[model samples]
Target: MLYKLNLEHILFLDIETVPQKQHFTELDEDVQALWEQKTQYQRKDEFTPEEFYDRAGIWAEFGKIVCISVGYFAPKGDQRNFRVTSFYGEEIKILKDFKQLLADHFSQAKHLLCAHNGKEFDFPYIARRMVINGINLPYKLDLFGKKPWEVPHLDTMELWKFGDYKHFTSLKLLALVLGIPSPKEDMDGSMVKDVFYIENDLDRIVTYCELDVVTTAQVFLKMRNEELLADDEIKKV
Candidate 1:
């Protein structure tokens, strides 16, 4: 059934986020107390709230999306060209630009958004960030009253689960097992915060995010038993 679906109708995407502030000390007193309380269970006796700040990017309330890279397949005569692009820079601007893209191009009912672990993370994180930024949710991201089957969203991780609810697979592990080329050669999710705050290399982070998009697409193609995308077919825009 996945193979029967049009590749052009799906958008594969990945996002990179970092703590709202460069450091824990940057947050005001009241917010610091809030952070301490929010992460208490996770921190436990191993680490203090301030010590766990680096992981705050996993939470929409304390994190900000710095980049969102998306890739879509476009039919090219006898072949398919996978084009990738990114929206980065100021968080509000990035959200606005991405919102415009969805409204202008992917508003149709047939269009679907795909990512690894998207249902649990990427999709909701983007939606929450959009609300926090006061941007209207695009049709694809808005799920107020849509039925389960009516939702136009896909998750490579969910597909891989195949009904095993307790199973958890990281994108890197999935790609490795599926024989798809590794996308973490340069950097990975763990190093994103330092790269953004210390190295100030957003371009690097963008490249990393785009690679994950490509990898997610490849994973979907693998699931459909389709040919993998060749290097020449992937174009960064």
Candidate 2:
């Protein structure tokens, strides 16, 4: 079934996010209390809400997207070129640009959004962020009443699960196991917050996000029993 789908119809993507504020104290008193209550189970007694604040980006309510890198296959005759681009900078701007891309190009019913663990993370994160920012949800991201099969989104992690819902696979680990080049050579998701807030390096995060997108596309191709994209075939625009 995966093989039958057109590769060109899929938009592969990855995102980098950071906490809404540089420090937990920066949040208003009310929101800070909310954060503490929200992460109680995960933090337990090991870490205070402030200590666990670095990971706040994992939750849409407390975080904001910094970058969204997308890659799509464009085949010309026998040649395949994977074009990659990113929407970065301000959170609202990033969300608006991504929404525009979805509306302008990938709006058709046949178009699909593909990401590693996207169905669980990327897809919903983008949707929640858009709503929070007052940006209209694109058709691809708006899944209000669509049936499971009618939704046009693909997840590499979900595909690898193959119905074993208990299994969880990190994109870096999956890429390594699948023999595709790892996207975490420079940095992983754990370092994204520091990289963005402390170092103020949006370009670095964008590069990493784009690498993940390319790696995801490669993983999809591997699943389809097709050739993995060569480094030369990937172009970042």
Candidate 3:
């Protein structure tokens, strides 16, 4: 019998992160001094660590979360509904809020959390920051120590390996390779941090995040041998 997944409980999520200013200078002064002299987008230029973050919007003053977008398959439907939420505050409060959302909706379900490179970036970044903030990690995020394939985790980038792992393809590039009409065709991750920092616009961040979740869900669908849905169907929620 084919396994029947509780689709509603599978949370496909992505988080946009810029380095934390507080942690930026933890490096040696020489490195820190060089880093500070340049913008994150400008590698050749020198920067003091502090100046780099100042221009890079790495401090909490630049707002903690630009966006938190999540997606899940709808029960009995061939579609995905994604919800994008924004968190703006100190990292501690934002982490608490993020933990609460998972606790409130997914605490008891057989939840499978999905992300692109979440194993290396999103998951650990959130966990370490949550600990630094004195907040207990949500149960769903406590599976870090387990072997990669043993946990209730799915990383779409890793999933692409089934097709021969043709080099490291970015989520956007993979979508195009699969003819999924790459979302975020207008913007990339580079602009996301700046959208939050310079424009201070939460809606753009939401849009960026929502695009990621939708793309991820599409990638997941393609992996499962299901027909891919259009952007309208994918973003219905």
Q: What is candidate 1's lDDT per residue for 1-237, written digit by digit as tens?
A: 797899999999999999999899999999899999999999998999899999999999999999999999987998889999999999999999998988888989999999999999999999999999998888898999999999999999999999999999999999999999885458889999999999999999999999999999999999999999999999988
Per-candidate local distance difference test = 0.94, 0.92, 0.65
Number of the candidate with higher TM-score, 2 or 3: 2
Q: Number of clashes in model 3?
A: 9
How many Å off is the CA of 222 in candidate 2?
0.6
Clashes of each: 0, 0, 9
Q: lDDT of candidate 3 vs native?
A: 0.65
TM-score of 2: 0.98
lDDT at 4 for candidate 3? 62
At residue 34, give the lDDT of candidate 1. Answer: 94
Sliding window of 10 residues with minimal summed lDDT for model 2 = 178-187
Q: Write the per-residue lDDT of candidate 3 for residues 98-217, one digit (tens) a residue.
A: 788788887774777888877666776677667766788788778758675557677888767656655567898888878787753566776765565567776666677777888887
lDDT of 2 by residue, 79-198 (tens): 999999999999899888888888889999999999999999999999999999888888898889999999999999999999998999988888889898765458889999999989
